[model samples]
Structures are given as C-alpha cells and as structure tokens.
Target: EDKTASDLFKHYQEIFPHGNRNAASHRWAHFVLQRSTQMTPGKVAYFFASFCPISGSPIDPTPQTAIRYESGHGLPQVSGGQAEGIIHHCCWPCICDSLKFLRVDTKTVSTSQGPHQFRFLVYGNPCTDPTRIPAEATDVTCSNGRLEASVLSDHGHVIVGMLQDNQPSIGASSREVLEA
Candidate 1:
C-alpha cells in the first residue's frame, strides 16, 4: 500500500499518542518518505524505537533526538520472528561527540574512551551532492557509533548484543514477547 503523509502521521499517533499532535508527526512523516521504499503504518509501528540508543533517554515529543534511522538488515533475532527493520533515533550531542574523531577515509568512527571504533556503512552510492542529501540526516552514514552495548528497552530480557553501525540492537526470546 502506498503510504501517504496522512497514513504516516496516523500511525505515528497510534504508537506515540502523547507526542506533538500534528506538526511533529507531520514533520516525522515527511522525513520517513525520503528513505523508505515501501512505507506503511504497520511498518512504522513495527520499526519505531521509543528511546534514543545513544543517551538511552525517552524520545521527546518533538523527538529532541533528531537523528532517526531505518535499517532493514543486520539486526539480532527477536522471539516473534526476525525484525524486518529497525527505526531508531539519536540525539545530536551524543552523535556529534562520537563522530568528532571519525575517519571518513576508513569508514570508522572512533571514540576517546579507547580502542572502540564503529564500522559505519552506507547502503547505497555515496552522495556526492550535499544538497541531494536529506536535510534531517546528521551524517552521510546516518549513524555515529554503537553508543551503547545494547539499544533495547527494559522490557524484560528482550535485548542483547552490540548494535551494527546503522542498525539498532534488539534481542528477544519467547519470554519477552506478549501475544497481541
């Protein structure tokens, strides 16, 4: 089904009802349009993350964690089934601090804490025209680094492992899944 801005906004509202009623969801819907090929409300609901992976903070109504992403591959398995994709968010401060030492030539974002480095990868041809890039993207790679060992919420022992550069981490077992 072709996802319209209305569809996106409606779904976002269903999942995050307390968020900004119109403006914020409208903006978020517009942002998703650029990156997704087959977008649907179900997909949005399935992929959206409630917290910022970097700061582990609850995503704000304006979604202060402006850096949002959708990764369709390379995520840990979940109990219900494999996750088709992950929609994750991150704050600017957390991402900027992590990318300060990024070596673009080597596709690595290193941190000052030590030898920790993330292999950042882009799915398509690198965008040569800065103007062509989406205005919401913080970096070309759309990811800074593995801000934490895990990005999953405290919904029991449902999450595990380090998140891939562009993908958010989620590990679920049967115990963590509730029948819908």
Candidate 2:
C-alpha cells in the first residue's frame, strides 16, 4: 500500500522517538533519500545534520568579515560607493553548538579608493569552523559595520543560494538545495 503523508508522519514519530514532528520528518526524508540513492554514509549524515539539529537554524556564518578599504582597490562598490560582504556568526556561545553550522564564499574587486570586497556566509546546519576556513577563500572584516554573506550548497543536482544579513535584522534565508 502507498504510504500517505500521515503514514510517513507516523513512521517518523516512531523513528525519531525524542524529536518533534518537524525534526522527525526531516530525518526520515534524509534516511530514505540516502538509502535510495546509495549515497555515502558520511555525505548522507552530513546532509541530514547540515542545519542546526535543535532550532533548525543554519550555522552562524560570521567568521571573516569584509574589510573596509578606504582606497577601494578590491571590492564591490554600491551606489554609495560602499563595499558589502559576509561575516561569520559564532553560534556556540549563544546557542547549543550541536545545532549550528556555517559556510561562506566571497569575491572582491579593486576600486580607485583602495580595496573593496563582498562576501557571503551561511548559517545553520553543518556549522563551519571559520578558523579552519576552506582553501581558495577571501576574508572580510566585520568590526566597523554590518555585513552579509551569500551561501551556496548543492544537494542531489540542485544549487541553492541564500543571503545572510548581519544588520539590525539578521536571520536565515528560506532558500534550499532542491532539484531545479
């Protein structure tokens, strides 16, 4: 017999045992997808716990912040001639470390001013260690002003992008890595 959403929900509740419906459903989906595609265990597990396990928040992406270049040599200048970029937001201090993750990538441009930069960071799920930043990365400084990071992740064959803001109103983006 075909399983309905309710049936899937019931199965998830049984499998999760200690989690809520949302968490259970997510886990179940992850398990089924992993099994069906014969994906590696490490990648499957990584995908399942990519976001915060408890609060479902993306890992904080505030590690390296954008550098405010007075000369605007290598940065993306906005209409106001301001360079915007991404920063890492550490979650271990504020929230349960078990439920945070992050990832980021940035590009900078050189302007007549000096050096300008733009960055993107992703938070929640798969908490990233900024100190151990991946290779081929550009760092941004975030002490002077607010910054933002755009995140990209691939799941199955889908590429998803999200914008993480670090201003007065900072939060997660609703974007997900789904097949196009």
Candidate 3:
C-alpha cells in the first residue's frame, strides 16, 4: 500500500519492456499473467470508485484511450531517434487530471444516482469544448440524469427514481485497510 507510483511504474516496466498498453496481444500477456497484484479487493474497488465523480451508480465501463506522442509534445526530443511515448493504462480521473494540468477546464455533472463529465478541444486558450459535453451535462435532468432524449419529461411533471435492492457499495466501509 505504501508503494509509490514510481515503484509501481518500475514494476510494470520490468514486466512490460515494450509498454503497458500496446495495441496488440503482447501487452495483454502482462495483464493476464500478472493476475495477483499487491492491491487488495477493497483497495481495488476503492481505486475504481475514485474515478467515479459521484455515489449511487450503475456499472459503466469506459473504452480505454490510447495516445501516441512525438518528442516535441512535452516529451524528451531525441535527435534522429524515434520518439516512443510511454503508452499506458488510465482511468477516467487520470485522463481528466492530465487534461486539466494542460490548462483544460474539465467539468463534472453530479446527480442523485451518478455523475457525468465531458471533454473537448478548444481553439485559443487551453479549455474545454462545450459542444462535446456529456449526455447528462445539463443541470436540469431527470431519473438521475440517465434518461434518454426520446423520453420526454415536463419540468413541472413528477419523475420517479428507483434504487437497487442488493448492492455492496450501499454500505461499504470508508477505509480500505487490509484485513488479517
């Protein structure tokens, strides 16, 4: 648990000489082979939930993003040598944080059931694109902001929301300590 990010990165590098996220099966081998990691079940769960912007949610898995950068793109520029950016696996927050670090203003919309966040490319200054926003980007929403456009709802009309009967996260512990 005390292992720094650099230590974990080194461990990954040792396993993946090429990279952690190649577009082929070679990268898959490392993830499949290294089935047992130091992360506990609770720790992993908490780690995943950290990516979510809010509480009370349905399962939503996002497609993994792959990016390849050149040497001049904030990376070391090697003379003549091919610039190999470190391809890696990233969660939602990791992606958003990186963009924000580059001065991109990212926004997250939170509601009763879950959250919604969007990203876009801006022209002048580093900023977020309003047109390329999340589906539930609007503040005035219905059914936890999970409703589709086909379903029409009047603002004054009443809308009902449901809760799941069995969900472990409903009463999970705040702390993710290892159990003996």
Best by TM-score: 2
1 against 2, candidate with superior TM-score: 2
Q: TM-score per candidate, in order?
A: 0.21, 0.22, 0.21
lDDT of 2 by residue, 97-152 (tens): 21133223332323334333323222333223334433322221122232112122
Candidate 1 clashes between residue pairs 3 or more apart in a chain or in different chains: none
The global C-alpha lDDT for each of the candidates, from Candidate 1 onward, is 0.29, 0.28, 0.25
Clashes of each: 0, 47, 0
Write down the lDDT that model 1 would get. Answer: 0.29
Off by over 4 Å in 2: 22-25, 35-123, 126-180
Q: Go through the candidates in order and give the C-alpha RMSD of each one to the true structure.
A: 17.7, 17.7, 20.0
Model 1, C-alpha of 36: deviation from truth (Å): 22
In model 2, the worst 10-residue window by lDDT is 155-164
Candidate 3, 140-163: lDDT as tens digits: 122333322111112211111111
Estimate, for each residue in 1-180, the C-alpha lDDT of model 1 and write its tens digit: 444334443554443344332112222322332333453333333223333333333343222333332232222232222222222344445444222211111111222232232222111122333455455433222123321111212222212112222222221211111112
lDDT of 3 at 94: 32
lDDT over C-alpha atoms for residue 150 of model 2 = 17
